[model samples]
Target: MQQVVIIGAGMGGLAAALRLQAHGFDVTVLEKQPRPGGRSSVIEECGFRVDTGPTILVMKDAFEDTYRAIGENLNERVEFVRLDPNYRIYYHDDTHLDLYSDPAKLAEEVERVAPGSGAQLARFMADSAAKYALGMAFVERNYTQITDLANPVALRRLLQTRAYQNLYRQVARAFGGSDKLAKAFSFHSMFLGLSPFEALAMYSLITYADLALGMWYPLGGIYRIVEDMLHLAQQMGVTVRTNAPVEQICIEAGRVRGVRLASGEEVPADIVVSNADLPYTYRHLVAPEHRRSYPDARLERMDYACSGYLLYLGVDRTYPHLQHQALYFSEDYRANLDAIFRTRTLPDAPSFHLNVPTVTDPSLAPPGHSLLYVLAPMPNLTAGIDWEAAAPVVREKLLAQLERIVDPDIREHIVWERDYRPTDFLHDFNAAHGTAFGSLSHGFFQSAYFRPHNKAPDVDGLYFVGQGTYPGIGLPMVHISSRLVTERILEEWS
Candidate 1:
């Protein structure tokens, strides 16, 4: 039997473990934290369960594919509740729009905001759906070399998808050049940690995926999916351990031998896969001699996704009218974007995403209480702002904004509260520059074939899976990345 050691039991790691085990490889996953899930882990505080990262589960097909590969039905293991009017977007002008999965309903909302936009909305959805289909086939696959980008089928799809056009521009043209409608449609790019104005038009498929396929919430919170995968991994006879931080990847000559834990214990392996932060794996985990292309100097030049200020509040009361998910756009949405990605400064009126799971699952809190997960995207640690001082001031600002939007006295109901900053991501997850998402922005140069490959370029028997590698950020991407890596492993062995 071939011995395999995977570092980090994150969603990607767990998926990889299950797939590889089914392929007859003996797999063991080592996670540093006391629990699994990595960034997606649950935080149980004062009787409230909050998902530490990634609240929404977009693209259910990607998730279902994983279980289907192992001859199991995902629905039997975990139940998912589809959210209609997926998200309520609050604009600066005190108006709101509800994005629905049904095209007719969405067209109604679009026409309500901008006359004549109903037809445009339908056309945009059809175009986006086509782009999404093409992307799934040509773009999302694993890439081992630059030549992979030159495939004729992928090139044809790229042109058909208008991959050369800017996402913001594409939405503007499709929606009859309405700024309001364009912002609403294109802002989904931010979820991938990219500005819509700069992200490739190919990414507009995200909006299609969200409004067409719909947003879903797994029962017990998003962390429930993680729990399910972990349970499956252990049941499949895969060795899983927590509190085992790997200090180094043991490399012999040019191939990976295994990993050395922080406890000074060495574990031997015939294959090794890392689901840790990509830049961190290259900069800190692997020895300097083993990294040829990703030296410290070159890595410093790479652009990273912005981090965020997170607040998990368990309130004594619930907001009955609040949707399952909501985004409050700042008065100056573009300025807010500039603050985080361009200027690397704090936005005076920062936009925020608010999640109140009680709207869907009241069991997360006391019968009448609620759990609020607030996230404000900000510049990563590369900005050099002192979070220790900024946190309190920002918290007050966020509270003031929440008070105006949520209720007159929203702060009074806070019975329990906690926050996570960029520094915490750095300390806890070894995320380079405290980036909550992962390596290199999703620009043209940093996407698809241009993104970091799954297999390490300089070493044999070593691979990567997760947000930092190809297919980029988001839970669906991570799940697909795991499948891609597992297939790569199978191909290498075969």
Candidate 2:
């Protein structure tokens, strides 16, 4: 049996460990942050339970595939509730739009907002569905590396999908030039850490995934899915040890042998699968001389996705009208995107996403209380802004924003509040430039093999997994990313 040491129990790390164990390999996962889930994770304080990352479960079928591959099913272990009014969008003009699971209802809503947009919305959905089919066939299933797409079929599909057309362009073309609608539809790039204007046309699949599948959530929180996966992995004999942060990927003669813990003890294994952030693995875990292309200078030039400033609050009272998910758009959308991605600076009036899971799942907060996750997408730490100084200002602005919509005394009801910023991402996940999602704007030069290789390009027995690698970010995509990387390793090592 092959002995594998997988680092970072984040979604990718855990998925890779589970897949390899199912392949009959000896797998032990080592995470840095005292537990699984690098960035998209959970936290508990004073009886307030917070998911802390990734409030929405966008694509769930992939999650089912993940568990099924391990001889179980996601639904059996975790109860997934389908959302009827999927999400509520709050425009700057104070107009609200609730996207429903039914296309007809959603179309009516769109028609209500933008008079002629109803027909445009229907056409957009049809086109996005076609893009989704093309995406599933030629894009999502396989790895994102150019080497994987080098196949003639992929090239043919490339002609079909036109991955380089730019998602923003497609949205603008299929629909009208309403910048607000464009920004709302194209905002999916944040999952990949890029602006809608900058992300690839392939990401149009997000629209398909959203309207086609609708949104979903676990009964407790998204963490329930993570707990289920960890349970299945343990049942499969995949060892999981928390509080054991992997300090180094022990390498010798260009081959990964094992990992060294933060405590300075090394455990030997046959291969090392890194579920940790890719840049961190390359820049810190591996020796510079053994690296192929990902040195500080090389990585420095790469665009990283926006890091976020988050405020997790547990309010002592309920605001019943708030939806499960809400996007509060800023008046200046393009400037906000440019500030975060193109220019790497903080914007004056930034758009924000608010997740009030307690609206749907009340168990997260104490009785009569609400849990709020306020996220403002900001430039990664490369912006040179001080998070210590920025977090409070952002928090106040967010409160002011929410107060306008909900109740004026919203802040007065706050029983507890904690903030997580780029600095936290850096300190906790060792994310390069304190990037939360991994890598930078998913652009022409940043997709597929261009992004980062699943297996170390130069190292003989090293592997990469998670959002930082091929298939790209999001909980579902990261699982797929790890499965592809580990499946290849199992095939080779077996």
Indicate which candidate wins on TM-score. 1
Tens digit of per-residue lDDT, candidate 2, span 270-360: 8888887788788888888888677789877877778888989888888878888888888777788889888877777778888888888
- Name the candidate that leads on lDDT: 1
| Superposed Cα deviation of residue 349, candidate 1 (Å) | 1.1
lDDT of candidates 1 onward, in order = 0.87, 0.80
Error of 2 at 388 (Å): 1.4
Model 2 spans > 4 angstroms off: 141-163
- Enumerate clash totals for all models, in the order shown: 0, 7
* Residue pairs that clash (backbone atoms under 3 angstroms), model 2: 144-448, 145-448, 145-449, 146-449, 303-440, 304-440, 305-440
